[model samples]
Target: MLDDATLRQLSKTRGQTLERLRGVFNAGVGGDRIENMLYRLIGNKDGSRDLQGLAEVLQGRNVKLWVVSAGTNNLQKKKGLVDADVDKMRLLLDTLLKISSRTTKMLFSGLTYRTDIGDQLVDEANEKVCLLIMAMNQEFGYARIEYLPPVADLDKGQHLADHVHLNERGYQMWAEILAPRVMELYGS
Candidate 1:
């Protein structure tokens, strides 16, 4: 979990700024406008949020949000967590329970095939994070939860980069699997 300060700091790093700008621009388009809506829907496949709109939704739903992603390092360092991280995760989960209007639902994922140890580490970490999400869902009595598994053949050169993040094809596969489950669980 990154502090707001930390996320801001990370945003200043070269690539992260571009990523955040892209996130902002992509999330800004409304869903009612045909062209913009299609663009936003395509871009939001991996669960993009307009921070302002998301905050509004949280207010509307009376829910607080927390997301945990599996990065490459989280895998290799399994069972070697720092106490600070453990505490932060616990606090974040607890806060979600306390703040959310309805019961919470956690979204998590497993490790994927990767080209490098770093990617593998992210995969490993994500696996652990997923487990933690499950435990939290149970512990806090979430209304619902879901786990997205790694694509089996993803490492076969279908991915664009380090094989950690997904390409559009990978995202589509992900959305197809996830959207239905989320709809079933939350009634979409």
Candidate 2:
């Protein structure tokens, strides 16, 4: 039960207050666009200070922006269209490329293992999600593709817990494998 002034103040505060509760209720309806508002405020033409801006200050050079996403389902839901999700992802990528053609590279990976006690249905859903990931890479030529082979069963435990999330060791290895490719693409 917020009044207009309180609602306006909440919107101005970037959702750190109860007045901003409207944002939570309106979540996922252009959620990406909404989230980008935070990014916009920090270190760009926007009026907020953030890490990216600080790096630009320290380096005495403009900081380039790059986004690497994993576990994006936490950010945006595909509404259980598990099988066709990849295609939808591809369409979104295409739109992004159109807007920001400067995006130099993308590093896409497939699900390699799972041991979560969540449910069998989620495991099956992940497999379908992986299929979409593969399809997205194949369908579009926006960025270089580097296929990371699934780790063998013995090595899977080193990289994954509950067959899905990366353990520290696995993430370290994943970063090691991905870093060179990303560096080469960005010419870093």
Candidate 3:
């Protein structure tokens, strides 16, 4: 999960600096792709569970926010798969939106710069990822969905050490930026 402790830390800071808010929930899994997430949602695998299952599990829990950081794994191929991936993502988002209360807010983190895997195919794939983000924001509107840009110049080593995953500093920066927005949405 890209150092979600940073997010927890950010939430803690928010409670200290602002209001006494509940802690953050870290439901992220490492190396999770969009397709894999769909599989998990439907319980297609032995140990995986679908979104309905997840909702059932968290039936009584107070879930006020959801932050999604996916689609980077879908960017290793060509442009042909972009539409399919976007469609799947839209379905996933729609399902989540339907399940959540109107007060719940969602944030989608955009794919960062990939400098290590500098192939033509990867570049094309990144372009598609950006397009997917744009389309989702345009279609859903800010009231329902918001997009978080990469923490820093991802091409630089400080933000993304491996070109794909966020470094420690990157995570901290990301959490710092996102915490305020989360507060705004949650408080409203």
Candidate 4:
């Protein structure tokens, strides 16, 4: 793996600002010295917070269904997806699946399309996300990991505030999508 200074120089050489490099990368892009360039550029996240979030869910409460959604914002940062990103994503979801009761249903939705960033970037990220979720379902051999592809026919500029966040209408639309599935696992 390239050292931080080396990556910093590489970033500078490429004229890519650290702020803009928040998405993803792999050794494949940089050859030998770069192993998961995303982690280096973004700073090692350590995933403590991710683990903590899961821990909180495990505390006393009964959670029959875990509705998980994330990754679009950072995914918007970089131009390409990498294998390390996929590995990290798999590890995170794998932990949840392994620890949670087998009967528990997990519903993970693909990243949303964004007009804030180029739709191309978000759309690309969304595809990687969709693929990872599918892979996780297959690899974990769990029948309960349900995936909802992003909605069709939703007006992004209208439904999203700042073309990224959910406006009131967006929230309603999202709820409509989630409700039936939630009811399926959670009941009335």
lDDT of each: 0.43, 0.38, 0.60, 0.54
Off by over 4 Å in 4: 1-62, 77-82
Per-residue lDDT tens digits of candidate 2, residues 9-121? 32343213222211121212222331242332234654474345222332322222222332223222323324344455554434333333344344444334444433344
Over 1-188, each residue of candidate 4 has an lDDT whose tens digit, in order, gives 22233234334432222332222221122222122333322334376642233243343334466655545545535574456665666665665556566676777766667775666776676677777777767776766677776666668868776655555566556655655665566552
Off by over 4 Å in 2: 1-81, 116-158, 161-163
Better of 1 and 2 by lDDT: 1
Model 1: lowest-lDDT 10 consecutive positions: 22-31
C-alpha-based local distance difference test score of model 4:
0.54
Residues 1-188, candidate 3: write the lDDT tens digits.
Answer: 22354344444442234343576556556667776766654444344642344544544455577777776677644353367887887766665566667666777766655565444555455466566656766776656666666554443566665756666566556666666776777666
Candidate 1 lDDT, 57-165, residue by residue in tens: 3334443223333232332334433344444544544443444555555454444555544445455455555676677667756634456675555543775344344
List the candidates' TM-scores in order: 0.49, 0.42, 0.68, 0.63
Ranking by TM-score: 3, 4, 1, 2
- Better structure of 2 and 4 per TM-score: 4
**Better candidate number, 1 or 3, judged by TM-score:** 3
Clashing residue pairs, backbone N/CA/C < 3 A, model 2: 113-163, 114-162, 114-163, 115-162, 115-163, 116-162
Highest-TM-score candidate: 3
Mind sharing the TM-score for model 1? 0.49
RMSD of each: 13.0, 14.5, 4.9, 14.0
Model 4: pairs clashing at backbone N, Cα or C within 3 Å = none
Off by over 4 Å in 1: 1-60, 63-87, 111-113, 118-123, 141-144
